[model samples]
Target: MKKKFLMVFIVIVVVMTFFTPSYAKNTVEFPEEDSTELQYQDMIMLFLGSHIDQAISDHYSFYLKKDPIVYPYQIEVKKVKRINEFREFHFVIILEVTPVVGPHITVGKDKLIFEVSPTIPGKVKLLKFEHLETHELPPVWMHLLKKKPSL
Candidate 1:
C-alpha cells in the first residue's frame, strides 16, 4: 500500500509541474517625441472640430430644419504656451456654415485656446473658443432659430 501511494504522489507532482504556466515580463517604452507630438495635434484638432460642429448643429437646427453642413478651413496652430506645468494650445480655424436651402455663410475665423493633460491622452477639455470675426446672422431668422423646449 505504501509503495502504491508513493507512486501516485510522484505521478501527480510531475503532471502538475508540466501544467504550470510561465510568464515573461515585457517592458513598454513611451512613444517617440515626434510621433507623440503628431498624435497630440491630431487629437486636439479632431476634438475641437467635432465639438464646434455639434454646437453649430444644436444652435441652428431650428432655422435649418436639419443639421447645417460645417466646413473647417485654415486650421493653424498659433502658439503653444505653457500655463504652469501644462501646455496650452492656440489655434485659428475658419468655419463655413451652409444650411440646406439657404445660402452658405462664413463665420470668418475663430481663435481657440485649450489645454489637454499630458499623462491622460484620452481627455480633451476645451478652455476657450474666441471668435476672431463675428458675422451676425439675420435677426429676423433668430426667432425661427429658437429651439423648442423639450418635455
Candidate 2:
C-alpha cells in the first residue's frame, strides 16, 4: 500500500510541475539602468510598431491644419535605428496610400517623413515641428491622428 501511494504521489508531482506555467523571470532591470539603448529600442518598437498612425496624425496636426478623415495608406516601419544605446532612434516608415480617399479629400499625394524622438520621460515629440505655427497646421490634427479612429 505504501509503495503504491508513493508512486502516485511522485506521478502527481511530476505532472503538476510539467503543467505549471513557466513565466519569464523579471530579472531584466530597466533598460534605462545600464544603457538607454535597450529602452530606446523598446520605445522605438513600441511607438513605431504600435503607434505609427498616431505619430503620423501627430505630425499632420503639428504641421498641417487638418486630419485625414480616412486612413488611406497602409503605414509600415521600413527601418529602425538606435543612436548610441541611450534610448534614441531614427525610425523610417513607409506609408502606401491606397487609391480610395474616403470622407476627406486627398491632398497632393506626398510621402510624409519626420524625425521623432523622446522629449519627455515617456512622451515622444516631433523634433522638427513647433507648437505655435498658427497658419501651418491645427493642433487637433495631431491629436486626431494619434488615436485610432472608431471602426
Candidate 3:
C-alpha cells in the first residue's frame, strides 16, 4: 500500500510539471540604454533635494555617450531650487560653450537659471532663461543672456 501511494505521488508531480506554462518567453522587454526618459519623474526630481550635480550628470549621460561633439559644452549644475508647487525643477547651470562654427576653445563661463518641465523632465521652457552671473562670455552668448530673458 505504501509503494502504491509513493508511485501515485510521483505521477502527480510529473503531470503538474508538464502542465505548467513557461513565463520566460512571455516577459516584457525594455530598451537597453539608461535614459532619464525611462525613469519615474518624481523619483528623479526628488534626487535634486540632495545631490544636484550627480543627478544632472546621471540624467544627461545619455547625451554624453555620443562619439562626436558638436558645439560642445561643459555644463555644471550649481544649484537646484524649489519654488511654488512640484510643477518644475529650478536649476542654476554654469556652462562653457564652444561654438561649432567660429571658436573651438573655451569661450567663457555664464551662470544662469533655467526652468525645466517636470512632467516632461528634460524639456526647458524657452522663456524661462534667467542670467544669474557672467564672466568673460562669448559675444553671441553675452548678447543672448544679457537681455531681460523674456521670450
Candidate 4:
C-alpha cells in the first residue's frame, strides 16, 4: 500500500510539474535579472514554439502544417526595452511576414507582440494581437492569447 501510494504521488507531481504549460491565464511576475541579447532571443523563440504547437489550421506546406496566422516568412524586430512596474519585461512586435523577407513593412497589417519574461527564458506571453489581414487565433488560443499583465 505504501509503495503504491508513493508511486502514484510521484507520478502526479512529475506530470503536473513537467508536462504542464509554463504559463498561466493569470498574470505572472518575473524577477529582476539582467537578460542578455541571446536570452531575449531565446525567449522569443521559445514563446513562438509553444504557440506554434497550439495554433489551429488544416493548411499544410509539405509535411509541416502551416498555421492560419503565425506563418513567419519575414520577421521585423523592434528594440527590446523593459516596461511595466518592475521594468523587467521586454517586447517584440512583428508587423509583417513576407517571402522575400527584407525591408520591413512598417504600415499596419497584422501585428502581435511577444512579451518575454526575465525570470524564465521559456516563459512568454502573447499579448495584444491585432489582425489587419485574414489571419486568426486558434480555438485553444482564443482564450489564451489575451495580454496577461504582471501580478
RMSD of each: 21.4, 17.6, 21.7, 17.5
- CA-lDDT, candidates in order: 0.48, 0.40, 0.37, 0.41
Q: Regarding TM-score, does 1 or 3 come out ahead?
A: 1
Quick one: best lDDT, which candidate? 1
- What shift in Å separates residue 60 of candidate 4 from its native position after superposition? 13
lDDT of 1 by residue, 1-151 (tens): 9999999999999999999753322212234565775666556557667766665565556445555544432355566665554334423333322222134443233555555555435444455655445344454434434443221
Off by over 4 Å in 1: 1-44, 55-70, 82-103, 119-121, 136-151
Model 2 per-residue lDDT tens digits across residues 7-125: 99999999999997643232223333545754554454555433444544554553344543323223322344454566556343333321112233332222333455554444443
What candidate 3 gets wrong by more than 4 Å, as runs, is 1-73, 85-104, 118-122, 126-151
Report the lDDT tens digits of candidate 4 across residue range 1-93. 999999999999998999865322211224377569546645654557545433222211221222333333233344455666555465444
Residue pairs in collision within model 2: 36-87, 37-85, 54-146, 57-145, 61-141, 61-142, 64-137, 65-137, 65-138
Candidate 3 lDDT over residue span 24-97, tens digit each: 22112345876574453334334332333333333224333311122211333444556556744553333222
- What TM-scores do the predictions have? 0.37, 0.28, 0.27, 0.33
Q: Candidates 2 and 4: which is better by lDDT?
A: 4
Q: List the residue pairs that clash in candidate 3.
A: none
